[model samples]
Target: MPKTTPTPGVVITRSTLHKAQELAALSYGSVWTGPSGEESSGEAVARHLEATAALLATNGWDRIWTPPTPAQLAEADAAATTETMLRQLLDYIREEERSASGRLTAGDALNRVARTADGDPDTGRIAGDVLDLVVVALTGHPSARFGYWSERLNRTFADITALLTAGALFARTYGPAPERAA
Candidate 1:
């Protein structure tokens, strides 16, 4: 008979497994050892299973995992564009409507603008430009308004994209793996 290939899995050392298990258990609150190191909480085997992914990650098992492709990076850039625009627009609108009465009206308008922009980057850009007019009308201070826009723009969308992309990749890559046989 042909030798069967072992079922695919990360080969981690026993110590790494122990440490990862401990950290994972702590994070999930499954086996919470009290501050005194005396008391402990109930164990949920199901929740404990949720910890396996983190175990794999911490063990250097995923070093061979594929890096983000160019297409994915481009997608992140597009998403970042829309996200950054929406955040800046929201902040600027809030800044322009500082008074209580204006805030009430601004709240409604802000919701409408958000709905209108939805996920489209172009619509976000347009909404932001229109909101800029409102800000200019509300606050006639040219220097202050320019300063705010400058600061907002300085927060590069690429940074936001990179952070979000990394988080998403981690979540996707670190899902629970099959249990080790006893």
Candidate 2:
């Protein structure tokens, strides 16, 4: 009998060392808790991989990408807005702390946001953001540095993931049968 080809499934593109540099920067910055001098490109890569592995181990999500339901998307949208407002508040507090006590704890800002928010603190979006960051760090390609990396990477990946996720959701919601092939 003739040999048959197996169906093509998900294709994961591995990160090249050059590509990994950018990812390392983004991922390391995302979870960095060490002193200023502690982070290097190589160290960032290690931290990125470690943090991603830990999240995967804890979450037990076998699939790399899952389409979000309409409700989940709405929740994520709300969470994103909250996160933006919180970041602005945190920045202002940091400046105030610099001029006053010369020290500020993130807990203070986070607690204040939660306390002041009028409605539900839609924290579920944080999980989605975290997952998106992990995915980008795990798969992103390196490029020329333009500006502040942490903010730039987060924004860049957020937009990218949103587009990709929307496509996935569209397919899942209205696409043809999975059995049909090109």
Candidate 3:
């Protein structure tokens, strides 16, 4: 793509780009801390944990059994026999804006810029240049995947991503996994 220069003052920082990348890692490992400083495990995770513990306690660590429900059996079968849900999901997101992945407006290009660039700056001509380039590059693409976003949205996603990332990193670094927390 040809270079795009933003109208003088529109700046998109590298940190902005980094934030976008982090938001896109939503499915990484089922581990993150929430804002309340509790285990990231909420109802969904708790159910999984409870089910697993019941299964282990009922049977034993060495035992394995078929999933109890037809729905579960279907899910298991789909694991190998079906097209990954990602393709269907991406299509659904594009058509209906009804998926979690659609929550991201432009993380991919932002991540590309952040990863390809180095030594992110806090302030100066280079910072301005990088941000301006980000705006231009993002806007250059059509309203397809990873396209333009308002700076505020980009910054917000970046911050959320940063928090989730820090939560995950600190949890792993400073404490045991939730099962071991007991």
Q: What is the TM-score of each predicted model, taking all chains together? A: 0.18, 0.20, 0.19
* Model 1 segments more than 4 A misplaced: 1-154, 177-182
**Total clashing residue pairs per candidate?**
0, 0, 1
Better of 1 and 3 by TM-score: 3
Report the lDDT tens digits of candidate 1 across residue range 78-129.
5467778677667656654442232112212223333332212222222233
Candidate 1 accuracy as lDDT: 0.29
User: Of 2 and 3, which scores higher on TM-score?
Assistant: 2
- lDDT of predicted model 2: 0.31
lDDT of 2 by residue, 36-155 (tens): 323123222232323333333343322223232222111234446777767766776666545443121221221223233220122212222333333443334233221122223233
Worst 10 residues of 1 by lDDT: 40-49
Q: Write the per-residue lDDT of candidate 3 for residues 1-182, one digit (tens) a residue.
A: 63344343334444534443343233243233332334432222232223323333343332112232221112333554346566565565555433222222222222322332221111111222222333333345322122233334323433323322332233233333446432
- Where in model 2 is the C-alpha error above 4 Å? 1-15, 19-41, 62-182
User: With candidate 1 superimposed using the best TM-score fit, by how many Å does residue 169's alpha carbon deviate from the native?
Assistant: 0.5
After superposing candidate 3, which stretches have Cα over 4 Å from the reference? 1-101, 104-154, 178-182
lDDT of each: 0.29, 0.31, 0.32
Alpha carbon deviation, residue 17, candidate 2 (Å): 2.9
Q: Which candidate do you rate higher for TM-score, 1 or 2?
A: 2
lDDT of 1 at 159: 26
